[model samples]
Target: MPGYLLVFFCGVLFAAGLGLSGMTLPQKVIGFLDFAGEWDPSLALVMVGSAGVYFVFYRRIIRRAHPLFDVSFHVPTRTDIDQRLIVGAALFGIGWGLVGFCPGPALTALVSGYDKALIFFVAMVTGMYAYRTVDAIAGLRTDEGTAVDG
Candidate 1:
């Protein structure tokens, strides 16, 4: 319960930060990506700030005996970047470049009554479900016979 509370609080804080940083706006993100144009650099600053905080805390947390609630840190062992990973990243990049609404920002912007962000969020969720359906149909699996091991 405490871990869940902590997660909820952290999520709220992150959403608040995004709202305060104008990251909830698609125009700001698109402006940042348009380097040939005026190019808003605020998003870069936000990324750097987030990375810095994560760097400091991630190391500190890993050094502890274990996660406060979990028995062990949920770390992935897969180091190889497979085709699925590459294609997924490319798709994400293209979506972001086109709509300027990544998952986080799109979800946050839902409160702002932004039609485009709402559309993007709907599309994103649809895409996830579509991928899951296709994977299930294709019978894609790891050597362990798990539906999701990657």
Candidate 2:
């Protein structure tokens, strides 16, 4: 398969998994998060299932220096808790909690045709672009602390 085809298939499978697992619905995520009141544990199964898959394949992926397509696997090397990282994380958490829409399911939720999902996704992209612009201007590289053994 072509590289773009592989990527598309992966995305399709991911979105399908999210849809089948009810992850595309914010109520499901919100229900899981609201542990104090009317909690739903179904999302826990999804997490476990996803984690299992990650655990199985992560080792294989890490064992190889490069991917199947010969592209180097880009890894974040930053260890310090810098201001940009802190602020980005805080913003991500706020967005997630506010709309129960993280990036993964936000894309999956596009199938639902909800205006709120569209709005959230737009805001998310805007935030990402804004961050990238600011980071580029400030020379804030995420891999600041890593010493590459080249």
Best by TM-score: 1
Query: What does candidate 2's lDDT look like per residue over 1-150, in tens digits?
Result: 687789899988988898899888898889988889799999999999999998999888988979877578765555667766666678778878777888899877777789998888888888777976777787776654565322
User: RMSDs, each prediction?
Assistant: 2.9, 4.1
How does candidate 2 score on lDDT?
0.81
Task: Write model 1 residue lDDT over 1-150, tens digit each, in one string.
Answer: 999999999999999999898788889999999999998999999999988998989888888888988898765556665666666678889989997888888888888787777787898899987986665565643334323332
Distance from true position, residue 53, model 2, in Å? 1.7
All candidates: TM-score = 0.85, 0.78
The residue-level lDDT of candidate 2 at 5 comes to 88
lDDT of each: 0.81, 0.81
CA error at residue 56 for candidate 1, angstroms? 1.9
With a 3 Å backbone cut-off (N, CA, C), the pairs that clash in candidate 2 are none
